[model samples]
Target chain A: MPSLLILMPLAGIMILNFAFGRTMKRSAFWFAVVLFLIQIILAIFHHPVFWSNELEMVDRFFNVSFSMDYISFIALLSIGIVSLVSLLVARCSIDNEEDRFNFINLLVIASIGMSGIVMVKDVFSLYVFLEITAAASFILIAFWRKRRALEGAFKYILLSAIATIMMLTAIALLIVLAGDPSFSVIKSALGRSSSSFMVTLAVGIFICGLFIKGGLVPFHGWLPDAYSSAPAPVAILLAGIVTKVVGIYTIMRVMISLFGFSASMGRVFMFIGALSILVGAFAALGQRDFKRMLAYSSISQIGYILLGFGTGTTIGILGAVFHFFNHAIFKSLLFVNSAAVEDSVGTTDMDKMGGLASRMPITGATSVIALLSACGIPPLAGFWSKLIIILALWKSGHVAYTLIAVFASVLTLAYLLSMQRRTFFGKLADGLEDIKEAHTRIRVASIILAAITVLVGVFFPLMFDNFILPVKDILLR
Target chain B: MNELYWRIFLNFSFFIIMLFIAGFYCILVTRNLIRVMIGLELLIKAVTLFLVVACYVSGQAALGQALIITLIVMEVVMIAVLAGVVLSIYRHNNSLDARRLRELKG
Candidate 1:
């Protein structure tokens, strides 16, 4: 089954982990990587790709369906690639063996839940999968079992629980009023004549919950803590795929498929996206910890994607997907690279160390590439994506938003460049001569993602046409 | 008049609301990590109840009930495992107030 292709990695991990609880770190890590590789192969090679029927179970109150299509394929590919790289990067912290094993299993579980949520057509099924992903993330954040780790997990759990409940209650109301959850059925029920009050009430609650999950501005209290505390590999998965998949991807899918781009809704999304961009970028500028800064940067980056989608043009949606793909690669690269830096320097405090390029060339070079890609620098992945989004804004005739986006992109570059300077250049601080390069697997992971970032930038059209265009068409339709 | 159905709906709604309030109170007031988790379990149970009752009222019992029960089982299993994890945290950290373990601050 197509579902199995996404789920098999989690199953494989469960077997290997539970049966061979004492397996060597290298074996466990390789086993997970190999499993993901097999998944990637199956995802690419499977012919006549069997999309499962929309399995539906209808009751008076709930109509549920599990459906997969081209959109699900996009999510699957992202999950497979990002998670494999994250796992390889996690192996450098050899001291936390048990935590590493647990983190790998949780990553697999979250990936399965994410892919499942994207594929499922029913709102209720989406809620269930969302919870699964959240729970897995909570456990993974607390994997380190430090004071901060538990605290971060607790905060994340509490906030996510509230958001999930809001989503569930909204679904309940939608089902009670509309009688079904299938995309086609719901849209028909919401036909051109539905009362504005009911529509507003329902849509507002749903969007608020989704915004919280996406870590947009006011609801982003848990993000910096969770991202900074989570193990580097797990952080990569969360930043790269988890937040985007369950939150932004689902919101975009549901709004386009069910709600249509009502003028009021579009304006609200645009405003929220803009606010998130400004707030997230400014907030990130002050962070001292590398991971924490990256966390805030993710929130800002997601704002651009949201802004692109909110523009409601075909070009706009395509640009959003392009940005999403680009962000996933570079952000994951940055997180893993931070792990490498931490592994070598014994700390993530950017100001405490310097001259890392001379010490750890791989981490320094790869990180610079990632940093450049993140800041929309030329000939890198971020630039094309940012250009597309800005062009989309201009074409949409939202000149003000276009200007704001350009401004945000520049601020993004400034802060990121400063971060790079503080961490990599200048004189080495006291007691730093003994530091070495990251573990073999960690370096391999960084180089792979770094290379992909450059390749995707150079061959933008190929990736855009083959990978992003189909998903964009599906969502836009 | 469909009085019986209306009464069932009101009863279930009251029960779900009460469970939610209790869970909120526990999350807000409790100091123990285990208790906090119990509060979460209670909240999830309330959600499940709400879903199932909503399905029944709307006359769609089969799918919702199945999904709710599946959710209940998942919560139970996951909560039990997490309870063990919390206990370990308490052992190592020497407190479960969840407020004291502030080691990873920025």
Candidate 2:
């Protein structure tokens, strides 16, 4: 039954691609919707017999297994919701019939890989799933097959290839040391031995690979280009969840659970997190393209999550996990809003847009809501998570990082508000007079995401008690 | 005899590292897309050699062989897709130079 989450999508892809083909391209969209609904339902009712400490067999024949902890559950839930939203947004935004069909199929496949990443207990299986997601994303990023899109895809693959090689090296080293690739075995082995130079080298290489995937400073060359060129729905998926699962989640899992968090590791994470925050915010300040700015903003927001986990405290981990969920909602909303604006006005450049609020009221309102939430405005989901992160940093005695995080939120507000002013508040641009609200589908998706942000914000205590506290407990254990 | 084997293993590992560095240098310096891909292939080869060596040293040849097979399959798929992208780029731009494919910039 647990395996169905992955197999169902593979079946959907086969039926859509080979069985239906181009003759029934429209059916692909409906097929994807059905598959997503089924997956979501399965996720909601997914009750594994084993809990955090025990591994349950996902595929007995292959000896593959997964564990269900609170962290994996949150990851599973977010991947389901975010993928569904992105699929809906894609259906509305993409006009090419063939492209739409292929896009939906690839997305479903990628979601399977993502869920696998969250659930898998062994490093080798994790690598396989991560590559699956990476392969799907490479094609999705270049779905349009334009020159720039291809260029972005090529650059992404090149960088990712290097990261993969580094990761493989690390895996080899770990396997050689522990004589097995399972996380539990590796943990016990490492715990018994003093930190050797070879182990340190392997860990360093592994973290470096993850840093590239997560788009941290000094390894973020592929991010802006890929995000800007990808269709808005793909952009939303990549920024909102893909990077988090492949990069951030793995980092947190390995550092905290497998390796055991150390003070020196925490300090390294704090420094990198702080650096990404400053760099991403400052770079975003100069961007004219709305999606590109949002892309940089994603980097800055991701920095906060990293900073939270970097503190290595229970509260910090809770804040990081909560912020991870919150960032997915608000960032997906913002990207969907960007898709709408681009679809209606035919440009993502903020300079090419103005006073769209009067014409596209829903988009304007949703974009404002998303931006506010992203900026950590009071009474929004972003604020509570950022507050928790800041509090965690301060309590952890990283006063300098806490100060920078607070200042970065102010910078986030400055840039996002300026973006709002340029795109929606001032006089209507001359050429965009006939612009109208986005299609009903796009509007609906954005509204759903925006509603989540607001609802989560308004019910913060309920969210903390019911959802976050359990995940915090698991991380700290 | 064991000491002699150790010396040989160290020399081989050092040689693989040199190959890895050379491939990395090729990727960084080359403007041609094909050359960059060649560099990537070189790095993969080096890594594969290193993996086999590690497995041989650790007496886990069977497990290492299985991993290498999987790695090779994945590597093939990646290279195939990358080649397709390169073909498209060449068709669109009429050149294989990375410098020419610059429509997207900050």
Candidate 3:
């Protein structure tokens, strides 16, 4: 059953807690590792025996109807991969056994929530799962109970609450017009009411909610704080998949399925996407903290995804989804590098360290690969996706937007390379000598992510038919 | 839209807007962490009311009520977590001022 994708992890958590409390705590990492691996395997292979079956009993009890497509497949794959990487980071970084146990539970809960997000067809179920993910993230952000983390969590809480309210209001409006919560019902309702002012107002409110969730410009004030102050593993989870799934993916799905991608909507998306790119790039240029800089870089990357998807063309959406996957992997790899640096050098302030590449060879090297991919350098996964987006924009006759995308890419290269040189390429900054590479698990995470990035880029031709073609079917739907 | 439903919306919207103004104003002005949480609660309260009225207007009270129940449950969990976070912030700084929470700035 498709619902098993969500239920399986939930079952793991329940078993972890009541099955054998303290004893299970020690084995929690392995349990989570196995669980995520299964999800990864299922998503990649698309096992028909598991996917084709359905449990009428469970479906009726939950009253949810889920349908899977290429979009959900891509989202599920990323969720599993990012969660697995985050798990490894947590295994090494969090020392306290109880704390680690709690973190594991939250990670699994988040996994279940995200899985629910990708699979659900009803908007109310979508809202429920979004809150589940958000709640788990709030606790995860405040896991350390440090001052910065708590503050960050508070800001996220307040903003997330506001975003929820906006979305609920929109949902209510849609239900009033459509009299149902299912995508098909609401979509038909929206189509019939397309000329109504209230239709425009509802769409506006809903998109605004998504923008806040996605951390787009004007609604991104809470994002950098939540991201930079979060613990390393939590940072990876939040940055890699959580916000993307909630904000950007929802925008894609809802616009395609419900609002039908109006021209005005497309224009609004392009304008805001461009704004986020310029603003996030300019802001990152001044940040000194390594994690903070990565956080801003993340905003800029999100702009690329948005800009591509905004084109509202099949090729453009294909590019956006591919870029989403690429961003998740490379960004996670970069965060893993930051975690490694923080573990050894005891700071994220980029100004403090230099020439450390000699010491942390694996992290330094993998980070180079990641940064290069992020800059859309040749033969990397980022290049192909970016090329597709630019091509789509050009074909659509949006020459100005196409140029803006290219210029911002140059900006991406500039900020990232400069930060990299300051942190890894200069003379060792007065730190005498004693430092070591990150833990084994961390290096393992770095290697795995870097491998995916390089392999996807290298095997682009073979994988595109397997991956990108499926995404085009979403537009067809 | 039905005429009765449109009239109901026109009447209910005034109270909803008032509640939203009150909630947002409180959130923007309040420095105390607890009050901030309270402001969040106010916003949610307004949303809940709004959802109910919308359901009534559409004559789909069943789905709307079910959603409200779920939302209430979710809201409680959220508030409880916020309270815990607020308590931690208080312990760290011995105060709940939002200004003290600005250490993460650029």
Best by lDDT: 3
Native RMSD of candidate 3 (Å): 1.3
Task: Please identify model 3 stretches exceeding 4 Å from their true place.
Answer: none
Against the true structure, whose TM-score is highest? Answer: 3
Task: Write the residue-wise lDDT of candidate 3 on B2-70 in tens digits.
Answer: 788799898899999999999999999998989988888998999899999988888888877798999
lDDT of each residue in A321-433, candidate 2, tens digit only: 99999998898888888888989888898988899999999989998999899888879999999999999999988888989999999999999999999988989999899
Q: Candidate 1 vs candidate 2: which has greater lDDT?
A: 2
DockQ metric for all predictions:
0.34, 0.68, 0.88
Models ranked on lDDT: 3, 2, 1
Instruction: Please name the candidate that would achieve the greatest DockQ relative to the true structure.
Output: 3
CAPRI-wise, candidate 1 is acceptable
Q: Tens digit of lDDT per residue, candidate 3, span A1-477?
A: 898777777877888888776888799899999989989898898876777777889978876567787888888999999999999999989999998999999999998999988887878888999999999999999998988989899999888989999998888888887889898888887877754878888889999999999999889998999999999999999999999999998998889887788778989998898888888998999999888888888988899899989888888889899999999999999999999999889988898889889888899899999999998997888888889889989989999999989998999899989888988887877863788889999999999999999899999987778977888867876
Each model's fnat?
A: 0.21, 0.52, 0.90
lDDT of 2: 0.85
Error of 2 at B75 (Å): 1.1
Interface Cα RMSD, each model = 2.5, 1.1, 0.8
How do the residues A403-435 of candidate 1 rate in per-residue lDDT, one tens digit apiece? Answer: 999999888888888888888888877788888
